[model samples]
Target: MTTVYIADTGVFVRCGGPDKSKFQRLRRALQQAGVSLRIPQRVYQELGGNPAADKYPSGDIPYADGFEDGWIVVAEELDYANPLVSTVMDEVRRFIANETDRDEDIIEKADTALVGLAAQVLDTGEADHVVLLTTDKPAGRAAEALLPQHGFSDSIEFRYVSVAYLESLTADEFW
Candidate 1:
């Protein structure tokens, strides 16, 4: 079964900064495994949309290199027209809202996009499995909880990209 790695904005944001060690580590691991992390268009936008974050040290990431090196590809647009994709996104929205104890309307589309993309990948036969790499707890939890209910048990995984996780990442993780 094919396994696609879907990453979030927080994962890239975590690798940002003047020190490129963490970023370099992740790049090497992905290259060694011959795998790339696909980011949703919303995540691509979030990575470059915030002008205020440019002033911060962690904001000075060389993410463009990943794209140039072919280790970071932007995922195809989310197909809301797909019933499964739309249903999963809606479930994710409500799950995240309930998990975070906030209004469903307040949850960002980007968060739901992660799971929605995963659903799309599976429904369209793009992949049999999905590994979501994100730092957003609510989204992660929602994926871990919801995907299984949609006949995707053991087919979806949520991996929290913590600082230590990135620092010691390896090709084995991808395999």
Candidate 2:
């Protein structure tokens, strides 16, 4: 089955900066696997939105290179009109809120957008399975728990993009 990798802002941030060894590691792995990561539109915005992020090396995202090289792509806008996508997004909002122990309104669209994109791809036949790479434990758990309820059992996975995870990344991981 075809699988799509959906990555979040934290994953990139965890890649560190200045040295870019982790970033290069991830890029090389994906290149060897002949696969690419699809980031939600909100994730792209989050990556570039915070000017404050520039102060830290981890925040110095070289995502422009990822985009230019075609390995990191911004996923299509969420189709809120699609019932499945909308429902999944709504559920994700609630799940994240609960997981984070915050009010539903405190949850941002970016969090839900990850799951929404996954649902959209599955509903549209864009991908048969989805692998979510993120450092946000709550959002990651939400996707892992909820997607199966929508009849995508065993088709959704959440891989916590920890420092060790990136350090050990290989093309074999994609397969």
Candidate 3:
């Protein structure tokens, strides 16, 4: 079964500078696994969104290189017409808001897009399964808790890509 891996911004940031061990480990693992991480378009923008991020050692070079090496790719646009996807996204938004204790308006669609895209992908038969890699606690729990209720049992999994998670990754993970 094909597994679609969707990653959030924290994954990139956690990799840090070009020479960091974490960055090298993630790069080697992905290259050896022949799997590129998918980032939502909004996440794509968020990664390079800050003009001030360049000053930090954890910034710049590495991310551009990750793209050049093909370890990062932007996910396709979501289809608004899918009812299951739409319903799931709305539910995720509420779940995220409740989980984070944030107001509804503070939770943007992009915050829920990783889960929505996964639902849409499965609903459209685009993939056999999905693994969401994120640092957002509320969003991760939202995906893990909700998708199965919509009848996508065992097809979706959320992985919290913390500072340590990708630091020791290997091709075995992809296999």
Candidate 4:
């Protein structure tokens, strides 16, 4: 089955420094798997949009190199017109708000886009399973807890890509 691996910012930051071993590990893993990490537009923007982030050693080089190497990619535009996409996004918005105990209005579409794209991929038969690679506990739980209820049982997997998760990561991560 084709599995889509969705990555979040923390994964990149966890790599640390330009020559961090974690970076090589992740890159090698994806290369071996012949699968690239999919970043939500929000994540892409978050990685490259912050000047403060640039100060960090890992952030200094940015994630664009991964993009160039085909180890990372931006998910395609979410078809907002698709009812399933729109519906799931709304559900994610509500789910995140509830999970984070924040106001619904404060949750932006981009925040919901991760789950929405995952749903779109599943609903469209683009992927049989989704592996969410994120450090965001609330968001990961939201996907795992809610996606199955929507009939994607056992199809959505959330892999908490914590510092420890990647700290030991190597080209064999997916192996």
Q: Return the candidate ranking by TM-score, descending.
A: 2, 1, 3, 4
Across residues 90-135, which tens digit of lDDT does each residue of candidate 3 receive?
A: 9999998888888988897667888888898788887888988888
- Candidate 3 error regions (>4 Å): 49-62
**Predicted candidate 2 versus true structure: per-residue lDDT over 1-175, tens digit per residue:** 9999999988888998425889999999998999999988788778873333432213445676777677888876788999999999999999888777899998988889999999888888888999999998888899989999999898899999999999999999899
Q: Residue 73 of candidate 2: its Cα lDDT?
A: 80
lDDT of each: 0.85, 0.86, 0.78, 0.78
Off by more than 4 A, model 2? 49-61
- Model 4 scores worst on lDDT over the 10 consecutive residues at 49-58
Report how far off residue 83 is in candidate 1 (Å).
Answer: 0.9
Question: Model 3 Cα displacement at 73 (Å)?
Answer: 1.3
Clashes of each: 0, 0, 0, 0
Residue 23, candidate 2: alpha-carbon lDDT: 91
Which model, 1 or 4, shows the larger TM-score? 1
For 1-175, candidate 1 gives per-residue lDDT tens digits of 7999999988877987425787888899999999999888777777763333332112434576787688887787788888888999999999888878899999999999999998888888889999999999889889889888889889889999999999999999999
Q: How displaced is residue 160 in candidate 1, in Å?
A: 0.7
Stronger candidate by lDDT (2 vs 3)? 2
Q: Which ranges of candidate 4 are over 4 A from the true structure? A: 49-61
Candidate No. with top lDDT? 2
> What is the Å distance of residue 102 in model 1 from its true position?
0.9
Residue pairs that clash (backbone atoms under 3 angstroms), model 4 = none
